[model samples]
Target: MQAALQAAGQGWHVFPLRPGSKRPALHGEQSCPRTGPCVNGHLKWEQRATTDPDRIRAAWSQAPFNVGIACGPSGLVVIDLDVPKNKSKGSSDAPDGATTFKALCERAGHAVPTTYRTRTASGGRHLYFTAPPGLHLTNTAGTIAELVDTRAWGGYVVAAGSITPTGTYESLSGLQTAVLPAWLRTILQPTPKASQAPATAVLGRSNRYADVALANETRAVASAPVGEREGTLLRAARALGRFVAWGDLPRHLVEQALQEAGQAAGLTAAECRSTLRSALNWSIAHNQTRRETA
Candidate 1:
């Protein structure tokens, strides 16, 4: 066993399990008791027994759920997904009980949870729920991804941002099912408001991470010399805004455009969805016109 384990790690932190002496793949099994007994152990379990009341209270305030996805000197990221209430649309609920992006197979229905580790010594756990029949992954994935981290127990999908995590299986051979119920409690301990706007850093406009294309576009508009547009500035602004809305661009970038468009462009993030709706109609009409001309 030691020989095989060492060979597998190719000389890494590999430990050989001596029948019943090893811990039960700790994280995958243990989890915040707020749910049920450790299901396939995907919640990435952790429990810090602190005697300090204030410290305990403070720690507890982070989230009723423990298990985060991170990679720091501490070996994992310690994230508290408890966003401010106002930012959450005045709801006391934390995103899917901090268990969104549950990892599962497409044909296998709902699987285990998802998780991810970050460079910032932080990680997140993605909670997976069964995708409704015929529902595309894009539909509710954004909302879920926006709410939870990707590396707690069952790391979520940070890139594809689809149904995510490919899921946590019980045994490499056997499949298991885990269900996360909705949180039903209001009047949560008061949390400080997120300053109407949480810190929004204007990341550089380099195509460093090409996947962040939407972010690049928003950076362009956000830093755009508002006066650069000629006669079609309005149209350009409108088109840009519509493009953002029609596409599932990053939320921050979408807002950046809305801010750049300014009042004259007459766009608001909340009201921007209609822009895509209108663009779709225009595209349909233009297609029909092209057919006629052809």
Candidate 2:
């Protein structure tokens, strides 16, 4: 109860999670009784989360419920830095989220900002930040880098006092939550449709084979199903990368086309950018010899 109240004191809405688990304790939609709070309709966890002290007290009194902080209502964008689950065979140097995030910051010519931080049960870190006003950023998985995720609208975070079977979540810093940095926000923000012009305008139709390949690959990425979208985007980027290396297509144009296609298929801007960049780099490097001989 005190744990939920502390989160509520920070102006963050709180909800109950199952004791010793991260799953929500509130009745799910399928089993909603539609009584009392749900008199009109089935209220989802996000909708039912509240900052009211009475409600928090009532809910927590029944059991030692874990606290869940709803990010959307709280106006927070939490950057989750996770540790690698398991080391690959013969590789003891698996990169963790903090290391990758630090590299990402250095590449952008910035240092990681000090903010309200928490240590998760699984030995992961959560860096809390205030969201930019009026920007409704959605949750992302591996959008910024491997093991880095951002949760905003439609997502929730376990409060600092919550405990799971693995371990307990504990606060690491008392520092104020920082406003999300501009460079990081730029990566998360979606590209406006008005700015995305047709690929033909950028790439032109001079090489029919290259043009056809670009169109086909991008189309495949855009139409890929949810489970296969990321792989499709990576494959498309790799397939088109050779054309860029061979001087048959411009790198920027190919990147732009594929990025837009990946976003269209529900991939986040950061995810597309990261995947496209790595895939293209590998494809270009590996195909350099073939390009030189041609």
Candidate 3:
């Protein structure tokens, strides 16, 4: 009960999870009693999660339930850095989420921003950030990088004090949550449909250099060998991002062209967006510096 109250005190909506488990304790829609909280209709875990102290106290008093924080209501975007499931398998070379996220930060010329964080039972970490105002971000899995998932709207995370069969979730960094980084926000933002209009109509006929670079890079990505496709996509995005930075090409145009090429090459939409966004962010940031120096 104290665990739930503590979470609620932080303005995070809390719900009960089954004791010694991560699953929500709330009755599901199929089993809705249609009474009390569900008198009118079924309320899913997200809807039922509340910051009300009385409700929390009442709920937790019944059992030693774990606490779950509703990310959307709390205005949080949590980056979940998870470990590999089987290190002994042929996946020994697979990088963990933390490593991938760190590499991503280095690519973008930034460090991992210090913020409120929690350590999960499975030896993973949850880095919490405040969601940008007026944007309804949803959950993402393996989109930012392998084993890196995010919980936002439509998702909940186990609170710091929660415990499960594997281990306990504990607060790692008690620091205040940082606002979601702009570069990451760009990546997480939903991609609009590709434009059907000709590129020359948008960028003007004089940008031949950028036009050629875009075409060559995207074509390379499309024709890249299966094993090398991701690397090819990353390199292509980084190379073309300079054009976007120099204002020779629109960012959306670059994104759209590369996105189509990536999809054509059999890369998942999420994978393409993640790779493109990260690579472009890095190239744009550095290219701006190069331009200033030149």
Candidate 4:
């Protein structure tokens, strides 16, 4: 408990985990009543996690819970090195976690700096580093290598002093959180933003006219919330419009299907008609470009 408080004192947003486990120690049972699969509550720790001393005490006082570190709030990025227990069953040529991490550092031409390290109960390692400014890193599995994962924004890592059935998460003394490496920065960073157009779906000219793209667009339109009706309709129109330009679906048939989908998604008739016209115009322009290029 004191260790958790101390971690919070050092600017880590600490939360309670279930004793002897890595799951969050949330108070209430949260489930999706309609869909039967909860979306937001599955990661409630990210929302209710805090560094406040009082909240930390209140949480831990009820039970001897393990400490969980909310990485994003703490401005920390954690490299999780997991060694598989079933390594003997896998191919011998497959490199282990340590070997993969070492090879990565070798490629970067420098050893990883000694950082605030935590030896996880499962015999894995968690190397802590300061996140780079304006670099939004999300959680990824095997992005670096097999058995290796990262916990960044929207993720949590069990903290040092947390004990579980496997073992205890113990700190490696005499180390500080180091700056993220330039090589790692390149790999872990978010992709640069580009144009807002949705990725084009490849079309084929086979006699099998299944209209799979239209079916997908219809589903998207139906599932979209009221606020997204306009954008969803526009995207659906553009996609179906492409098929029209490719001489796959007839223009009138495509327009009718789009109009039906837009109306089902709660768009006004006027809005649907106007968006349909614009999309057909876009398709006309697309065909014109193709002709000019040819």
Candidate 5:
């Protein structure tokens, strides 16, 4: 561990990986049985024992500061501590079960400060953070897990190359390291500032995709609730504006899964309409919650 930190000091790329390399950061053994075939055709996301140890290490070498740890496969399900700034320095605008990530960067010395945010599967928020300078990035990752707010779940996948915006890993450019700084033994997220977008010279808006982006967001706002036909319903709602009515919602055959989820419930037409209304309401609330937390 000390050598890796020294290498980082010399600007040599390092990857702080576990023995199995399924995760870049070290996490105590935590596993749950998933008997059926895993979604990626494996048994479970966290079943590190199933992964080829060689591949886990290989993925860690993508670039300097990129570390690999054995995540039990389901990936790290961290409770992100990222939050927007409070309305005032102490206006008590903190989120429910939330912590601020912005403060950590300001406090981190000799480190290129970074803050990250991601959406949870439940439309909640997740925050990303680079390990402080001189500490192994993987080590920082491990520490942050403990610092996460109560909203987080301890176990999460630590696979590399994942585009999860909520995840934080190695350095991307400019005097980067494959590992985090060794100096930083531990860190906790900071309190947020305000929620406004940074007030830099507003570069002319990227208007080319404005229409499409709004449509997509609104469509996201209208998609099914958390526990519904998540994939199919989202696709169907995305095709909403184009369709004249529910019949046209399919707009068809995107998948063999058409309304079967609720059909077995034998809901009446009124019940269906009421259920959809409820879902729409739920989606809007969820999106709003996300926006506020984000």
Candidate 6:
């Protein structure tokens, strides 16, 4: 409880978790055990999570619950390094978990920055880092490497000092969270400009309007909610693809933006490519139909 208060003091939004469990201490119709029907009891703790001391006090006062820190609002991203309780074989010599993490760092050509590391109850590790601006990194598994996962926006991580049946989340002494590395950023949160079209092509005034439209649509896709991301990506693709149909923007540029936006929303590169192809085809057909009608 004291740890939770301290986290709130440090400006990290916090909420209570069921004791020794990672589940938020939420109440709902399905959650209640009483014979009476649940009344105004479904708690959306993720949305209601706050830094207010009085609320924190009231919450922890009820029971010795664990602390859960909301990652996005706190501007934090956590890389969860989970070791298998049972060992698994790979690549004749490759090991999963922390060993895989080491290999990943080596492959990236840099050491994992010294940061706030927490040892989890199951002997896993959580490395906390400040999130990059405007990029909402989501939970990923096996994307970085085997047995490695990440927690970011729309997610939460158990904070240090929380105790579970397995063990406690203990912080390693003498380390602070570090800024995310540029190379890591490239893998985790790539930008649309990485594959930008060359400047050699002279743009006519008609094309200039398309350029502005693409820029706005790109921003909208980037900022869309996770639940809405796929639709947003399709919409952006159709809009930009319309410009491509009209020869206002290069087809490659529209395709690139859709690829970047799709990946940002956790789609595989191949998935993005496939979706872009379908969306572009629909857009071209729709535009042709409109032109014929006109």
Top candidate on TM-score is 2
lDDT (C-alpha, whole model) for all candidates: 0.27, 0.82, 0.82, 0.71, 0.31, 0.71
| Candidate 3 segments whose C-alpha is farther than 4 A from its true place | 88-93, 194-294
Taking every candidate in turn, the Cα RMSD to the unseen true structure, in Å, is 20.5, 11.0, 11.4, 16.9, 21.1, 11.2
Backbone collision tally, model 2? 0
TM-score for all models, in order of appearance: 0.19, 0.70, 0.69, 0.60, 0.23, 0.59
Candidate 3 lDDT by residue in tens digits, 1-294: 887898888889999999999999999999999999899999999999999999988888899999999999999999999989986355767788899988767654468889999999988899999998898999988656778899999999999988898899999877488999876776566532223222344455436767888898899889876545666677788778877876788999999999999889888898789889977887787677323221
Which prediction has more favorable TM-score, 1 or 4?
A: 4
Ordered from best to worst TM-score, the candidate numbers read: 2, 3, 4, 6, 5, 1
Could you tell me which 10 consecutive residues in candidate 6 have the lowest summed lDDT? Answer: 190-199
lDDT of 2 at 44: 88
TM-score of 1: 0.19
| Candidate 1 segments whose C-alpha is farther than 4 A from its true place | 1-94, 97-99, 102-147, 150-216, 219-294
**TM-score, candidate number 2:** 0.70
Candidate 2 C-alpha lDDT tens digits along 1-294: 988998898899999999999999999888989998999999988999999999999999999999999999999999999988874344548889999988777645468888999999988999999998998998977757789999999999998999998899999989479998876776566423211223343244325657788999899989977556666776677777777876677999999999999989987898789879987886777666333111
lDDT of 4 by residue, 1-294 (tens): 887987788788888899889998774454433221234344466766777888878778899999999998888889999877775466456566767776556533457667888888877789898987877788977655567789998999998889988799999864478878765765565432212222342345221232766677778776666545655665566656655765666888877887888788777677678767865666455553222211
Cα error of candidate 1 at position 242, Å: 24
Clashing pairs in 3: none
RMSD (CA, angstroms), candidate 2 = 11.0
lDDT (10s digit) by residue, model 1, range 1-294: 222221222211121122222222233333344353334333432232112344434443543222221111112211223233453365655544234323211111234334321221112332223322332222121212234322222222221111113222121111122222211000011112213211232223212222354344344434433222111222223333323333323434544444454333433443334333333333333322111111
Error of 5 at 249 (Å): 69
Q: What would the per-residue lDDT of candidate 6 be over residues 1-294, giving only the tens digit for each residue? A: 897987777677898899999888767546665432224454455656779998889889999999999988877888889876464333335464778777556543457678878898877888888877787777766545567888877889898879888889888744467777655554455223312332333457546767877888888767765445555665677667766876677789888876886777666687567557866776776564223211
What is the Cα root-mean-square deviation between model 5 and the actual structure?
21.1
Off by over 4 Å in 6: 29-43, 88-94, 190-294
lDDT per residue as tens, model 5, 161-237: 23333343332233222322222222222212213322231323322222343344344433433223233233333
Distance from true location, Cα of 128 in model 1, Å: 13
- Of 2 and 4, the candidate ahead on lDDT is 2
Sliding window of 10 residues with minimal summed lDDT for model 2? 191-200
